[model samples]
Target: MPLSEHEQRMLEQMERALYAEDPKFATALEGSGLRTYTRRRVYQAVAGIVVGIALLMTGVIVPNVLWVSVVGFLVMLGCTLLAVTGWRKAPKPGEQPVSGSAGGSAHGRNRQRRSMMNRIEERWQRRRDEQGH
Candidate 1:
C-alpha cells in the first residue's frame, strides 16, 4: 500500500524532528556525510603505506646496504602499523541506528537499515509517479 499525502508529510515532519533532536542519529539514518572522520587521515594512511612499501622494497634490493634496508623496513612497518590502526579506528557509514538503545547485533542493524532505506525509496518512487514526473 502506498502512503497517502498526509502520511508522507507526517513522515517528513517526524524525520525533521529526528534530525533536529539527534543529528548524529539522523546522519546515520541518512547514511552519508555524518562521520567526523577526516579524509586527510585516510589519505595520509594510504601515503604511509605506499612509502612503507617502497622502503621495504629498497631495503631488500640494495647491495651492502643492511642498515638502509633495515631503516626502510622499519619505516614500512611503522607506516603499515599506523595505517592499519587508523583504518580500524575510522568510523563506518551509518555506524548506529536512530534508536541507539535498541539491542541487536551488527548484522541485525544492517538488515534494519536496509529495510528502512527500501521503504524510503519506495515512497519516493510513489511520489514521483503521483506527480506524473
Candidate 2:
C-alpha cells in the first residue's frame, strides 16, 4: 500500500534527520540488499558458466568423456538462464520497486517503471553535467 501524504512527509523528515545525524552511516546503508544479492547471483552464474566451459574443454580434449561434456553443457545452460533472470529482475539505479496493490495492474506497473527509469536517466544526466564530464 502507498503511504499517505502525512506518512510520506514524516518518512522524509526521518530520513533527513538520519542523514544529518550520521552521513557516513547513511551512506553505508544506502545500498539495497536486494541489489547486492542479485549482483552476487549474476556473478556466481558467470563463474559457473566459466567452470562449465573449462569442463567442456576438458571433456573434449580427453578421450571417452562424452558424459562430462553433456554435464558441462547442462551446467552452462542452467547458469545462462539464472544470469538472465537475475539481470532482468534487478531494479535499475535509484528505482525503488513498490510491492503489492500499490502498483495496480501489470500494465500500470510497467508504465510506472518506464517513467521511473526515465527520471533516473534524467538525474544521471544532470549529475554528469554538474560534474562537467
Tens-digit per-residue lDDT, 1-133, candidate 2:
9999999999999999999999777755676755786778788999999989988888898999978888889899999999987677655544444345534546676998999999999999999999996
Among these predictions, the greatest TM-score belongs to 2
lDDT of model number 2: 0.81
Q: Model 1 over residues 23-113: C-alpha lDDT tens digits?
A: 8878676644324353545677678767767776776788776676677667767767776765565556666322343354556769989
Best by lDDT: 2
Cα deviation of 53, candidate 2, in Å: 0.9
Question: What TM-score fits each model?
Answer: 0.41, 0.47
Give the poorly placed runs of model 1, Cα more than 4 Å off: 1-17, 20-38, 91-133
Error of 1 at 133 (Å): 68
Model 2 ranges off by over 4 Å? 1-29, 92-133
